[model samples]
Every structure is written in C-alpha cells, then in structure tokens.
Target: MTLLESIKEPQDLRTLSPPEVGELAAEIRTFLVRAVTRTGGHLGPNLGVVELTIALHRVFDSPVDHILWDTGHQSYVHKLLTGRQDFSGLRGKGGLSGYPSRAESAHDVIENSHASTVLGWADGLAKADEVLGRRRHLVAVIGDGALTGGMAWEALNNIAAAGNRPLIIVVNDNERSYAPTIGGLAEHLATLRTTDGYERFLTWGKGVLQQTPVIGQPLYGSLHGAKKGFKDTFAPQGMFEDLGLKYLGPVDGHDTAAVESALHRAKRFHGPVLVHCITEKGRGCLPALADDADRFHTVGRMNPLTCEPLVVPAAASWTSVFGDEMAEIGAERPDVVAITAAMLQPVGLTRFAEEFPDRIWDVGIAEQHAAVSAAGLATGGLHPVVAVYATFLNRAFDQVLMDVALHGCGVTFVLDRAGVTGVDGPSHNGVWDMSVLQVVPGLRIAAPRDADRLREELREAVDVDDAPTVIRFPKEPVGEPIPAVGTIGGMDVLHRAPDPDVLLVAVGALAPLCLQTADLLAGAGIRCTVVDPRWVKPLDEQLPVLAAQHGLVAVVEDNSRAGGVGWAVGQALRDAGVDVPLRSFGVPERFLAHAGRGDVLAEIGLTPVEIAGRVSAVLERRAAAGERIRPKENGA
Candidate 1:
C-alpha cells in the first residue's frame, strides 16, 4: 500500500522511522497540492505546514491532548494527518470543509477560521482542564502574524496571569500573513531573524573566549549570559516574560527534529511556554512563493480545459462595485478613506488602495482596531468606509457599537459576504451580520438587491452624516436586477397584483427568489405581491402599512430567521397592531456546514419553489380562518 493509504490515524505516524516520516511529509505535500488545486481551496498555507504537522502529531497525543489551530486555514495538513484524506469532495457541496470542523474529526479542538483568536482559546482550554483536573495538554498553534491582533495579547495576558498550565503556545512564525505581517510584532521578528542566524556566529565567538585562557570557562559562562541579556535588552519580548510564561526558541520550524525537540522540552515546563518556530509560508510551492502578495491565500474553481478561473458572473461583484465606486467617491471627496482588516484584495479594495494609496489602510487582521480607527477618522470630519468580511466583522462588534455608534460617528461599515458564504465552512459564513449589528444604536443598515443599488447605497452610506451606517452584500456577483413595479418609502414594490392574497417582502439578494416565487404562486392563481425592501433596518415605514392590506405577508431574507429584517418587519406590524398574520423565511438559527450557497439556501427553505409553497400554505390557513383577500391601495 502507498504511504498515505498505510496511515489511518496519528498513531500510525508515530510508528514510522524518521526517514520514512520525512518521505511521508513529501507525500502529504504532493497530495495537498493536487487535492487543493483540484478543489480550489487553501494551498500555500497547507504546503507550508506539512512537516510542522508531522512534528505536532508525533509529539502530542491529540484528542486527549488538545490541538487548536488559530486561523484554521493552515490546518489542512492537520486534517490530512488525522485520517481525513478524502479531498475528492473537499470544499464542494458535501465535501470536506476548507477549515477545521468538529463534526469531521475529534482532533480539531476549535472551529476558528478568524485570525488572532487561537491564543485566547488556548488560555481558556488550559484553564478549563485545570478546573476539571484533566491531565490532557492544551496546545495552540498560532501564526506569528496573528499576534498583531489585540485579542491575542489579551489572551496572552490572561495566560501569563494564570501562570504555568501545561499549555504549549506554539508561534508558527511563517514571516507572513496574507501580506507580510504589519505592526510592531513584525519588526521584533525581523530583529530575531538576524539574531537567530547569529547564534552560530555566537558559537564562533565562544571559540574566541575559549582561547582566552584558564579563566575562560567561568568567563565564557558569564559572557554567554551577558550576551543573552544584551540581546533581550535590545529586542526584549519582556511583554510575554513579564506575564509569567516561559519563552523558548527562535528555532528552525522546517527542521522537524528541532520542532519536536522544542515541543518535548515545552511539555516538561511547568508553566505556559511559547515555542517560536520560524517557517516559510509557501515552503514547498515555488510558484506560490514567487507571488509577492498573500501567497495565493485562497483559490477559486477554474475551467478544466482552458485552465482559466471561473468568474462568478459578468456583472461586477458587490465587493468590486463598492471598490470601483469608493474609488470615485474618494476622488470626488478628499475626506473619504478606506480600511480593511488584512483583507485588501478579497474585499476588493486593491484598486482603491492603488488609486488612493494615502487614504487606504490595511489593519493586519485587527478588525477591532480597524473599526475604532475608522471611528477616529470620522471624528476628525473624514468619511471612513470600513470594508470587512461579514464574518470577520463579528470580531469588532464592541468597537462598532461603542466607538462608532454610541459615539455617533458617521463611519460607513461595508460588509462583503453578508449572507451564506460557501466552501469556507461555518466559521467563515457571513450569516450573522444583520442579527449582530441590529443592537448598535443609531445604525442604519441597508441591503442592496443588485449591483446598481449596491453602487448607489454605498454612495449614500458614505454621504450619510447623522450616524453610523452599514451596507452589506453577499459573496457572489450581483446577478439579474429585479426592477421595481412601484416605489413606496424605502421599499420598492417589484410585483403587485390588483387584488393581492399574499405579500412577498424580499430583503437584498432574495428579491430574485421572491420574483420567482411570485411567478410560481401566479401559476397556482395565488396572486402574490412581491416587494424588495432596499433598506432593511429603518424598515421602509410602508411595510407595516402594506402588510395591513394583505391576508398574509411572507417576509423572505437571506439572514438568520431570528432578529433579521423579517423579524423586524413582523415586530413593526405587531407594534402597529396591523393584525395581519405573517410568516418569515430565512436561514435557520443554527451553524451551517460547508455547502454551496444555493444548496444551503434550498435546505433552509429559502428557495423560490419552497417560498411559494410556504406562502400558499399560509394564505390557505388565513382563508380557513375567514380572512378575505384585499385590493391594493394603489390599484395594481
């Protein structure tokens, strides 16, 4: 059998000879390249961690000894080692998730795809183990770049305050995160970059001291201690040491023996120990290494024959629309600026960066910092658009609420991937933005139904000066437009029957699906009226008024069913005492696993056929209760 086929678990790896283990690393790398290339998933991050993964699995007993991968993107190699070699369906509809999934394996301790969160998890797990009197070791493998996040420091502080637990905080210093890690940590690491190499030179300097005479032994010992002190004084990581955790390494991460050796030493230490292992980001992949930015962070599906990446659609994505319009907005108004939390290209701010280099800022995975800084910019009488991924924005909720909204700063928060995002898995899904952002005081939230509205709303968001405003959109390109049949307040009536039995209120991208449902219901002689509420939050004042005229009002949204636009509309009708019965159609209030966007939507009963059937059933129930169908206020 092949090397990969011979292994079914981590125990199988421990049995292999060192040479065989090295060969197995090679095999794993090859498998990852081919598998991820075919699936269009994270490739470079996994390629860089093959040997590190081998060392981790070999040294620690996982499932018993917890292994937490901070960002989870680099855990692809971990998945391969943990007996999950089924890449045939990786990141597809029912395939293996791109990130770690607890449902997939017990070895994965946390489903963390967000950056700078592993350290905090390690601290908590280690503490819990202590409280439960469990002997299992808690190990958190965090990227060096992730240290730039403020949350990591908070975790580090707590870890230090808790003193030594059998927690191994491995800093996988890959020298990069998307774009060469920014801020103070990067500079400190740069100092160690030369200092580590100079250790060999320190050995040469030891020779010089040895030649100094009979007193050289004691003198050399004292001088060696002095040299270490000197290094620490100049490049002091006293921040970690002061917290009471043992600091180890600056070791070569590519050397499996060195990594394994350091881990073994850390296991013996009584307190929390940080083992800093330096490795390359795209170690085995030449093409990825040569790429100047992000090292091909995440890839997309491509044409098999032409070898061309498949475009989402011809019309620009909501992200690109925001990017293109923001560029013009920035040019037109000198006060306008753009910000992203280490997601410059993914959020489509690359062109914005290029056009307005002075106005754009990449905050290095610190979403909290990005949000507060945008608030500061707003306070200074400048317009700051904080464009971040829908999921990552969760990290900065407090900052958005307190610093931006509570303070009443006019910061424009643009969320890309505001609904279900496929392939990247549950941790990366943008489903909770609307639900989470609802509590922010004086925040105006808008959802664009198509590309044109995305452009216009983004412009309006930047221009709005009363309070903080958020404009969110999905991952895919804006498809076909749903032209309004009529306009009332912020809601646009897309399809209205002269005598309406049901009202279909579509929020954002769900308008097209609403139109399809209307067509289906028309065939069934249900006479449905569909409206797109462009602005979801201050909920189109006319929605309750419109709901009062119908027997049944069905609200369709792509967000969580609880606390979504649909729920808001229902509450509005309740407050107004409209008495018209309503039904809400949206994603369920549960974590969704990795699946295609359409597949996920259908499963949640958000599809056109499902919505139509559901609406018809509700209308039938209302009719059974003796409610009569009503005519439109403005006759359709």
Candidate 2:
C-alpha cells in the first residue's frame, strides 16, 4: 500500500519520514483529482490545501488542539487524515457531507459552510479553554478571502485584546474565495506577499540595532515602543502586530517543512499569533491550475484526464437568462450597475462585467458589504442590481432591511439559486429566502416561473425607483416556457377550469408540479384552476377574491412551509374574510440533506403525485361533510 493508504488516522502521519510525507502529499493530490472528478465537490480548494493540511495534522493533536476550518469546503483533506476517506456517494443522500459535519466525527467542529465564521468560533473556543484552565491550543485555519468579512475583523479585534490568550490563526492566502478575492484586504495581502525582502531587511535591522553599544540598546527600545510606525517605515508587518498579536512568516504553503515549522512556532507562542502562509488556489492538477475562471473552485462530475464534464448539458439555467438580460439592460441604461459578493460568473454577471467593466463591483465574500454598498450605489443616482445566490442573501438580512428597504432605495436583488439546491447540502439550499424576506416591509419579491418571466420580472424590478425588489429563481435548468393563458391582477392563470373546485397557487418554479397536480385532480372529477403568482410577496389584491370562488385553495411552493407564500396567502384569505379551507404544500421546516433536487422534493411531498393524493383526500373529506361547492366568479 502507498503512504496514503497506510494512514487511517492523523496520528499515523506522525510516523512518516520526510520523503514519505512528500510521497503522501503526491498520492493525496492524485486521489483527490480522481475521486472528486467522480463525486463532484470542492476540488480546487482541497487540492490547494494538501500540504498545509498534512502539516497541520502532523503538528497538532486535532480533537485536543481544536483546529477549526473557516468555510469548511477546504476540509476534505482534513477529513481524509481523520479516517473518513470513503468517496462513494459523496454529497449524496446518507453520504459524506460536502462541508464539515459535527455528526461525522469528533475531529469536525463548526459545520456552518458560510465563509468568514471560523474566527469567531475560534475566539469562543479559546475563551472557554482559558476560563476552564485547559491547556489545549486553539488553531483557526482561515483564508485570505474570508478576512474580507467584517465578522472576521470583529473576531480578530476580540482575539487581539486578550493579549495573554493562546490562539494560532493560520491565514491560507490562496487569493480567492469563489473567484479572486477583492476589496482592500486582497490588496493588503498582495502587499504582504511581495514584501519578503522588506521583512528580511527589518529582521536584520532589528538584530543589528539590539547588538550595538549603549545608544543602540536605547534606540532598539525606542523602535520597539513605536513598532507600528517603525514597521510601517520598513516592512509594514504591523497590520497584525499593531492589533497586539505576534506575526509570523509569509511561509511557502506548499513546502511541508516550512509550514509545519511556522505552525510549530505559533503553537509554542503563549499569545495570539498570525501565521501568513502563501499558497496557490489550484496548486496541483494541471487542468485545475490552467482554469482561469474560478480555478475550478467547485465542479460537477467530470473526466479526470480532460477535466471536462461527463454529464450532458441541460437547457439554459435561470442564471444565464438573468445574465444575458442584465447585459442587455446595461447596454440600454447607463445608470444600471451590478454588484456581486465574490461570485461574478456563477451568478451570471460575467457578461455584464465584460460589457460594463467600470459599472460592475465585486465586494469579496462580504455579502453584508455588498448589500450596504448597493444601498450607497442606489443613493448615488444609480440603479444597483446585486446578484448573489439566494442562500448567501440570508447573511445580509439586516443590511437589506435597514440600508435598502428602510431607505426605499431602488436596489434590485437577483437571487439565482432560489430553492432547493440539493447537492451542496443544508447550508447551501436556497429554501429560506422567501420565508425570511417576508417580514421586510415594502420589499417586493418576484418568483419567476420560467425564463421569460425571469427576463420580464428583472426589468420590472430595476424599474422600481423606490423600495427594494427581489427576483428569485431556482438552480435547475430553465425548462420549456409555461405560457400564461390569461392574466388576473398580475397573476398568470396557467390552467383555468370553467367550474373550479380547487384554486392551485403555484409559486415560481413549482408551476410544473402544480399543473401536474391539477391534471391529476381533474382526472378524479375534481375541477381545478391553477394560477402562478409571479410576484409572491405583496400578494395580488385579487387573489382572495379568486380563491373565494373555489371550494379549496391549495398553495404550493419550493420554500419552507413556515412563513412562505402558502402562509402569506392563508393570511391574506383570513384578512379578506374568505372562508375557503387552505392547504399548504412545501418543503418542511428542517435542514434538508444532500440529494438530487427531485429526490429531496419528492421525499418532502413536493412532487405532483404526493400533492395530488393530499388534495384528493381533502376533497373526499369535504364531500363526505356534504359542504356545498361555490360557483366560479369571473371578475378579478
């Protein structure tokens, strides 16, 4: 067996020789490229951290040391070292999670996949350790990309204030999060990366000043007193040092010995220490290294040799449709600008960026900054469209409510993965946007059912000169257009029965499922009229009237059942004095595991067959009660 196969636990790495450790690194990279190509996960991030992870495992005792990973996508190598190397069914139902899971192992902590949260976790853990008088070391492995977040800085400030606290913060500077990291932090890191000569000169100067005559000792003390200014004049390593933390190397992250040495030194230090390790995002695997876009950061199943996707391409996704339309919109409106939270291409702003370079801004992995900045942009007489994944929008809820909605700024939020993003697991699924954004007063949310509506609603959202507007769509392909046969107060009447018994309210991409359920109901002699509420938030004024004519009103959506469109519709009916019994069909209010979207939806009873069966049961019960059916009303 090879060095990798021989190792089952992190302790086993301690037995390996220098040459064997190097061999293990090679074997791990080769295994990652093959296994990840088949399983489809965070390949580039893991590949980048092979040597760094190996060094961490070799240097620290893990469970005892409390090593935490920020944005746990880079923890695959950590997983492998901790004896969870089985790659089959990765990110599938009942399989290994894509991110760190506390349930998976004792070694795993902080399962949250959101970026820039590890520092806070480390601070808390370190504080607890100190309070309890535990000798365990607290090591937080963070990325340079994650440092852009305000939370990371907040944690850093707290960590710095506790001067006697033992905390080792290893900054894995790979220079990218989803895309290349942006903002002032990236530029600051870039300066740190290039100032090696200055660092060397400063070290020599410090030693020389300390070794000189009586005047030299006093001069050295004076320089140490004003170290921040001295470093600023010479090396500028004062960023972390000024924060009352010990600063270590710009160590080559790929060199195992160098990284291990730096980590060892930090561990020995009895106070807060920052170890800056420079590494490439896609260090190994030529194809990943060659990838200009995102460095193959995250990928689907692909050929290991060619790095080309093995699966067949589906129809254009909702993101591409929005992207194309945004580019067109940008060409027409000079004041139309775009903002992204470090995801330019993924959210479909690449074309828009290319067309209007100066108009587009990448705010790093800081969603809070992105939302607040969009508010500023809107205030500056520009209609700012912030494009980001639906799940990530949860991070900026306060900013969205206070900065955008409160000010009534015309900031359009385009949420790409709006519902049930299955493979990436619980933290990634975009099922909470509708439920969470419901309480934001004056905020209009549009759930586009198809590509055409996505294009149309996007234009409509931007046209709103006051109040925040959100246009959200799912992760799946934008399938065949489901054209509306009629319109009633901005609602699309997809399928209308002459004498309707049930009013099927379809929210966004759930239109197809709603239509299928309607057909099943029709087959069972239950006449159903299906309507797609394009704008789910601020329910159409005519919805209660339309539902009042039907015997039952069933609302179906892909978001959480609690506080979703169904709940909102039910409230509308109750307020309007419509006594129609309502049933809601949606995802359960629980964390959904990793699986295909269809499988998860089916499991949660969001499928047509399940919905149809429930509706049929409800109708049967109503008939048994001998309730009189209401006649259909024509006017909206």
Using TM-score as the measure, the top candidate is 2
Clashing pairs in 2: none
- Give candidate 2 regions above 4 Å deviation: 198-230, 629-636
| lDDT against the true structure, each candidate | 0.83, 0.90
For model 2, state the Cα shift of residue 187 in Å: 1.2
The whole-model C-alpha lDDT of candidate 2 against the native structure comes to 0.90
- Quote the RMSD, in angstroms, for model 2: 2.5
**Model 2 alpha-carbon miss at residue 446, Å:** 0.4
lDDT by residue for model 2 (311-414), tens: 86679988889999999999999999999988899999999999899999998888999999999999999999999999999999999999999999999999
- After superposition, candidate 1 runs with Cα above 4 Å error: 233-239, 302-314, 631-636
Report the number of the highest-lDDT candidate: 2
